[model samples]
Target: MTTEPTAADAVGPEQEAVETALVETVVASFDHCPDPRLKEIMVSLTRHLHAFIRNVRLTEQEWAAGIDFLTEAGHITDDVRQEFILLSDTLGASMQTVNVNNVAYADATEATVFGPFFVEDSPRVELGGDVSFGAPGEPCWVEGQVTDTAGKPLAGARIEVWEADEDGLYDVQRDAGRRAARGHLFSDENGEYRFWGLTPTPYPIPDDGPVGKMLAAVGRSPLRTSHLHFMVSHPGARTLVTHIFPEGDPIMWKDSVFGVKESLIKRFEHQPAGTPTPDGRQLKTAWRRVRFDIVLAPAGA
Candidate 1:
């Protein structure tokens, strides 16, 4: 006796042909796009998206849930908080983009995620000045030199820095009109710079939203490793955005945004409370120090 066809068996060449035809139709719709790059991207995106749907055999309910998740992500985003960036970071898209754009050059500092907290028009600071600006954290003396990939000094390069406090909170996360633990300084004629910043500390990404829920659902931690953020820019060189992870951070390998690189990890030396600071500032509490030499690749290299 012959058996009747089941649902799985019924989904054969006819269904596949229909699905493939749909993808082709969508891709063809962009054929008239005037911009070549846009047309290429849209065509590829349509093909990949259709392929994903087919591979998963996505259910209507699952598609609707994804739409809801993105909608909530948009709702939670604001001037200070960027939920979409959080989503991209957690999904590793941000790092992938960084890798694509930041090709490696000899001894050039590796790039990483540009977290959502950076602000425009940060207060400018003199060399050796304090960036902490009264943010609550253990004192940290940070010194560095900026150079080109060829080892030529890059004087006057603007180094923008920011980080969370000892309590793992950025200045923007606290009361409005408050700014601390962040500032910018220009490298001196010798390509050297120094500043007082808070000791690096591990912090959770702002997770009171959809991104947090997704991480929890996937059994993933939202904690980033202890780090300090830096954005170095100079004329005729590619701008560098990166983080320096403390060498001993327990979660350095498990950073929520995958921002840590072995090359970016540096030692933070501890100094006794009574030890004289490099610039002769007296402190009643122990402080840490770190040195990070930055090298920038030539633009468009």
Candidate 2:
């Protein structure tokens, strides 16, 4: 005994009731979805979206423009960059996502958003090697240890590191002949890793695109808080993605990336010794030093 479709369903009336029905249809679709994580995300997203539509009384014209803007954002992606990540960074979504997952930072390196610029297989260098590649900036010696919560040296941990140049740009963003300011290093038996590079400098986010326009509309600067990037991982340990924001950086307290945590902010010590290079050339009038430790969670926990 099948019943006929009602007039409300057949007419597909373009009214508020129709909008409500559309929203209900979307909500009903989630009930049949299987993946717990995906279901959670989609359900929450749909709820918030419906609320936004109701609250703002969003019009078809506005939504069409929003879709077009997103399509344009997609057109901006390339091998070395991602516009959507730029959108997330500009909107503070990246930081929010990281913060939700990293509830505690006790003796642990704070996880930060891995921006689209991170390129793997960065030149592998030895301890005390300089990846600065002659860029102009304050010389810095970064020394750090990778360990477990129990303080055991994380032997053979792969330390993936990258940083922008003195002028605030990554190698992927420029055409430097040499591998500019990026490398990978393995921690030693003592769970120690060291590298020589310029101290991090504050720089702007990609603001020339729609993401940048959005930030400008919101009266925000696109600058990232000054910091260095690290991806430290070991066997049977959690891989850590984090930043070492410079102490006393104006933006340190308000990192645009939301990568800042009390433990990850490191002080740069000014060395008056003016250490000489291997060839005896005076490195700089004032060199900086930073020491920090990273702790990882047990694997598969």
User: Which candidate wins on lDDT?
Assistant: 1
Regions of candidate 2 where Cα sits further than 4 Å from its true position:
1-18, 30-37, 103-106, 176-178, 273-284
Could you give candidate 2's per-residue lDDT for residues 97-163 as a string of tens digits? 8777766644666688887778766788897777776666787888878899888898889888888
Q: What is candidate 2's TM-score against the reference? A: 0.86
The global C-alpha lDDT for each of the candidates, from Candidate 1 onward, is 0.93, 0.78
Where model 1 places Cα greater than 4 Å from the true spot, the runs are: 1-11
Q: Per-prediction RMSD in angstroms?
A: 4.0, 7.2
lDDT of candidate 1 vs native?
Answer: 0.93
**lDDT value for model 2:** 0.78
